[model samples]
Target: MRHLKYFCILFVITIVFISGCGNSAKTSKQHEGKIQITTTIGMIKDIVNEVGGEHVAVVGLMKSGVDPHLYKASQGDIQKLEKANIIFYNGLHLEGKMIDIFKKMAKKKTTIAVSKDISEDQLRGWDDGTEGHDPHIWFNVKHWITATKTVRDELIKYDPDHKEDYQTNADAYIKKLEELDQYAEDKIASIPEQTRVLVTAHDAFGYFGDRYGIEVMGLQGISTASEYGSKDVSELRDFLVANKIKAVFMESSVPKKAINAVVEGAKKKGHNVKIGGELFSDAMGEEGTPEGTYIGMVRHNVDTIVDALK
Candidate 1:
């Protein structure tokens, strides 16, 4: 169904491009006054908005609670991508299903993976794909600052007229991220060392855990596509029970069935566990809320975890 959806959308986009209805060059030329950017996820979009300010108009292809791992582009989304001046995405197969489309776009436009600038040593080990770095680089504020700098550079190249604006915005955003990084460190530090474990629906927070000094376990693997079988649930249940873990989290973009199953399995073993509040894993919150933004989302997750465990 996912493949079929994207295939149909691509076919429609191909017709639009052939018809010159939404040709990238023509649209870009028309919008020369403002750089039109298209991004895959909300986090990338938020960074673009901060850096680009009034100079760029960013259209995010993915919305709140949408799982990039399983997202398929729609006909409208393809049209938006077709008309974009530059496209930014969280590569490293984070958008696992959109690799071919991104490759196709790179031939004609400034299609970029913002996370590409970070060194491999800074990234956690990822077993899937040819790229070994974990794609959740945004979870680490420092890595995210590197990606934001890349975004600023791309914007400057495309629209040098607003170079100062982009630079100022990037610098300010990075400053805030630095503060956020420290806040996470201090908050996680305040939690008792034995209780600083985070168990979630998936391994999306490996980078988060590594950066903030928390131990993380996911019932599912790095990719949501990975299997979560009886053994996996049983082992996590045993670990949680033996250690008396206070909370297990569910991700906004992922179903809660697996986490619930873990809870059930723990119950069968005579231990009661409660669901920690939903964390914004693969996506942010809704558009209007504080949690919708990058900093707010991180703070919300950290506060929730700290309060629950402490």
Candidate 2:
């Protein structure tokens, strides 16, 4: 059934691509006016907006609080991708369901995975021996610096006329990311070392934990597509009680049910565990809020975790 759905989507994309050929002149004009970029997640959207600035117009397929693991492309999204001058995604199977769509679109357009350039040493593998590296690179500000550079170079490659602007914008953004990295280090250091364990909805913060020196655990696996049975929950509860963990976090993009169950189980076991706060994991906060941007989102998470754990 899933295979058939993907096939149907590809068929629609093929028909749209064939029909769109006649509008090449108009498409060229639009591309000439402003680079139309379609990104998969809010983090990439924010990076493009910061680096591309006024030279590019970006549309993110997934909105705030929308989990990319389960996100399916809509007809409107296909239109956006069809008309885009470039498409940027996290890659490493982050957008699990839309991988085929991205590959199909890449055949004709500039579809770049911003995470592609990160070296193997910098990436963390799944503890369960999952095939791919973790996709939550944005959690580590330094890795996001790499992604920003990738976005800058790609934008320059596609739109060389704005090369200087892209370079300048990227340099500035990278500097900010550097400062954000230091801030995270300092803030995370404030939490007592023994209580520095970060428990969340899923394993989206492995990079974050590695970068900031925190022990991270999640109720669900790396991908939300993977399920967590009662055994997983009970085990997590035991770990929390054993450590006297004060809080576990809920992700903005993930349901609270699993974390809630853990909390209830901990309570029944006579260990109180509060929901630390909602962290922006796969998705970010709303557009206008501070948590909406990549830097802001990281700062918010660091502050929330420090405040709760300290």
Candidate 3:
């Protein structure tokens, strides 16, 4: 009887140990199945969600309205990148400061620069007179659709198990982006030709202006990190006065003081130029807001520009 009791106790112990081991194995498999994805900006994260569906856990390094040109990644961001199965970023120096770290990660992980597929000829002018593409390709809905496709293809390459789902989601998203492009074109057409001039704190909207036939003037160059000079202000003020432009715009990521200076200088020249609206240049709106999504961001900008310019 004593021996039987001792054997029963050992059997129970063995069963508990096996059960714990099984549970641990199950948890490990669950963690392994989870595909961790990291994106440079919130916009790319949004696209990744569209293609990845429920299969991925996605994180964005830069928050909404954060200037990518001057972004400094935190230690947590590096950890996220290291654990990520796949990483995506808007290339063409959009994340100018984060470029070095991203390049290093590319050596180990599946790092994809989505905007690398954009053609050189389609890009806008450079200070050096070369085809330096604007990194804000998200502004143009058509270009973004192309980017979405690129993202889908890359995601499919990494995760072939969900290729059909990725393709389906990408196609649906592209249709929505197409509708957004048409909406932008219609709204921008309502603005008179002369008033279509978009002057802002920086030249981030070069792609936007080119796409919609609007002329853009900026106090600073493509990079918001670059300092704005008095000469830039003087030249912009003269242009506003000479053109009789009624509105100048401010960017969400750029400091308002520079734009305010333009407004003040224009007023001194007897030109009544008002701030058109806060445009989403370098970044989109807050995460939960309507302007957070790429389509919503472009819509909000077009609506703002049309209301101010028309």
Identify the leading candidate in terms of lDDT.
Answer: 2
For model 3, which pairs clash? none
TM-score of each: 0.88, 0.89, 0.88
Estimate the lDDT of model 3: 0.86
Residue 58 in model 1: shift from native, Å? 0.8
lDDT of 2 by residue, 152-220 (tens): 999999999999999999999999999999999999999999999999989999999999999999999
Model 2, position 63: C-alpha lDDT score? 88
Model 2: how far residue 307 lies from native, Å: 0.6
Task: Compare candidates 1 and 3 on lDDT and give the better one.
Answer: 1
How well is each residue in 77-130 modelled by candidate 3, as lDDT tens digits? Answer: 999899899999998888888889988999999999988788877766555355
Q: Which segments of model 3 are wrong by more than 4 Å?
A: 1-32, 128-132
In what order do the candidates fall by TM-score, top score first? 2, 1, 3
Clashes of each: 0, 0, 0
TM-score of 1: 0.88
Highest-TM-score candidate? 2
Model 1 residue pairs with clashes: none
What candidate 1 gets wrong by more than 4 Å, as runs, is 1-32, 128-131
